[model samples]
Target: MKIAVVGATGLVGRKIINLCEKYFDSDVDYSFFASSKSAGSELEINGNKIIVQELNDDNISNFNISLFSAGGEKSKLFAKKFLDKGSFVIDNSSAFRMMEDVPLVVHGINEEIITEKTMLISNPNCTTMGLVMALKPLHDEFTLKSIFPTSYQAVSGSGTKAVTSLEEEIGLGDDLTPDYSDGFYERPIAKNVIPLAGTLLENGYSDEEMKFVNESRKILSIQNLIVEPSNARVGVKTGHGTFCSALFENNVDVDEAINLISKFEGIEYWADRLATPLDAEGQNDVLVSRLRKGLSNDKILNFWVVSDNLLKGAALNAVQIAKHVSTL
Candidate 1:
């Protein structure tokens, strides 16, 4: 298989290259693509140096599959160009996720919907990916009535620049105000929590919070499901942790729900132990723990979920989509 990784120099894109080499057989051929600023740079893959090429229509059309992690604008501009050339694009951005034609996919939850014609599939936001993976199995037994989620997302979710900002701030003394070079974040992300992730919409919700609410319903195939989400930026470097309190349609046995949740694919249940961001870093599976019953409703349940935002949230999901495509 010939694979091209767009945005090959970014955090998520770099992780995708590593995963493809780690999981796929030695026979697979891989290529790297990046912006003109990063062109001609060499990326080490499987102990071989692969030169990164500038992404353009001509170069993109040559690959059988292209994994895009660059951003909404880059995806909006180049996705169709790659698809028009008969290449399958597994996008890790929110650009095409809610589109009527594009399928927002998570391999363990909805791998069956994937087909050869599915040229551009969108991976859900990192926070949403973890929430849905933990909720889907229970939603199957008892439909999800409503969800209230609070996320403690890592600085890495904002990309490489944010990571640099945090490191620089830490290096400076506490009294020194962290300088915002490109205005990456509204506030200093070191030793502080920012209540917002994405821009605030007209509805008073940040784009990140709305992504969890909207994408979860779309991926789960439930139109009227109610989701109340509050997104926060924590001091963590990689993993994203979400605490969800959900209500179901019909009363469900707590033990059965726990058992069912434990069996859900891509999720590891830790009933006695609590899952943390440090534990989830570099892992592909969503770690779920801190399960509890809601006090108000017997049908409601609360739980905690965590996963590597760069892996299951982005790179690993894109790689899984490619694996699905290869099987077809």
Candidate 2:
């Protein structure tokens, strides 16, 4: 198989490359591509350094599968061409996610949607990726009616530059901090939280927040499922934490729910301890804990979710989908 990783220098893209080296067959031919500024730079994988190609129409084809973690605009520009040229495009951007024809996939949840006919696939936002993985088994058992999530996103999700802004503010203090500068968030992110993670839309929901609302419904195959989402940027370097309150159509069974999630494939639950982003950092598993009652209602339950925004949230899930699709 021939594989390509777009946005090869990025945090998510680097992880995708590492996993490709680990899981891809020894005979697989792999390449990396990036923006013109980063095009000639080197990305090292499995002790070999490979030069990144500039992303353009001429150079994107001839690959069996192309994993894209470039921003939405670039994915919008490049994905279709790759798909049209017979490379299965697994996009890690919100660009094609809400489209009717595109399949937004989580590896185990709705991965069956990626058929031999599917040329393009959408990977969910990093935050929503963890959220839906934890919700699927519960949605299967009790039939989810509504979900509310408050996400604490890490700075790494914003990309390499945002990480620099955060580091500068942390390492050097206030003098370097302007009101807000390039690649930094709207406000500071050191030892403080910014209530918004994405641009505020007309509906008062940030784009990051709506990904939870929109992508979860799509991945769980629940068209009518209602989601209320709140997103914030924290000072953490990696891993995103989400606290969720869910309501089901039937009465919530704590024991049965616990069993369903604990035994469910991709997520793990801890009964005695609360799971944090620190515990989930650098890990692919969605660490879920804190199952309890909310609103004192038998139908409502609360849980906490954590996962590395780069690994499971972006790269691993994309590769897992590609792996599953390769078998069929």
Candidate 3:
């Protein structure tokens, strides 16, 4: 089988390449693509050196599957080109996610939506991906009525420049007098938290916050499900954390919920200790802790979820979808 990895030099793209080796067979043919600026660079895969090609109309190849993380604009231009070549396009961008026909999938949760005829799939936002992974299992058993989530996301989710900005801010030591001239974020991201993570819309919610509401409802097949979301950018570098409170139609049992979360694939439940972003930095599974009954009523349940935004949130989810298509 032949596979293509676009945006091969990016933060998420590099992780996807690393995970392709882990999830796919050794003999599968792999091709890497990047923007013209990053083109001609070489990446090692399976004991061989592979050169990254410039992503353009001329370089589109006939492959079995193509994973795109080059951003929405590039995906809008190139995804269907790969699709017309008879390739399955699993996009890791916001481009095709909300389209009625495109299946927005989080691999292990609702991947059954993918079938023989479905060719283009969209991976969810990194924060939404981790949030839904924990919510799916509970929603199935308790029947979710509403979701209230506040996300604490890391700078890595904003790309390499944001990560560099955080590092630069941290380098100033105890002095907070540095000019905010060159930073990517609106506020200092070193020892601070920004309440708004994405572009603010007319409705007063950021794009990232709406992704949690809209994408989760679509993935779970709940069109009118009530969701109130807030996203904050934190000082960390890897994991994305969410403190979620959900209301269920039926009564929730804490023991049964823990049991269900533990058995679900790609999730780890912590009953004895609290799970934090530090513990979830390099793990493939979403970490859940501090599960308890909400103070308002018996039907409400609250929990904390964390995961590696680069791993399970982005690259791991995209590659897993490709693996599923390969089996068919």
Top candidate, metric TM-score = 3
TM-score of each: 0.96, 0.95, 0.98
Residue-level lDDT of model 1, residues 1-328, one tens digit each, is: 7888989999999999889887777677788888999999999888889999998766765578889988889999998888887789999989999999889998899978888877789999988998899889999998889999999999999999889888877676575465543335787777778888888999999999999988999989999989999999987889999999999998867788779877877888887778899999988889988787788878898888999999998999889889888778
Give lDDT per model, in order. Answer: 0.87, 0.87, 0.92
lDDT of candidate 2 at residue 300, scale 0 to 100: 89
Best by lDDT: 3
Which stretches in model 3 have alpha-carbon errors above 4 Å? 177-179
Q: What is the lDDT of residue 239 in candidate 2?
A: 92
Global CA lDDT computed for model 2: 0.87
Q: Which ranges of candidate 1 are over 4 A from the true structure?
A: 176-183
Candidate 2 on 1-328: residue-level lDDT in tens?
8888999989989999888877777677778999899978898877778899999888866888999998989998888888887888899999999999999998878888888888899999999999888888888888899998999999999999989988878875665554645438878887768899989999999988888888888888889989989999999989999999999998888888889888988889988888888888878789889888666788888999999999889999988987876776
Error of 3 at 227 (Å): 0.3
Off by over 4 Å in 2: 173-183
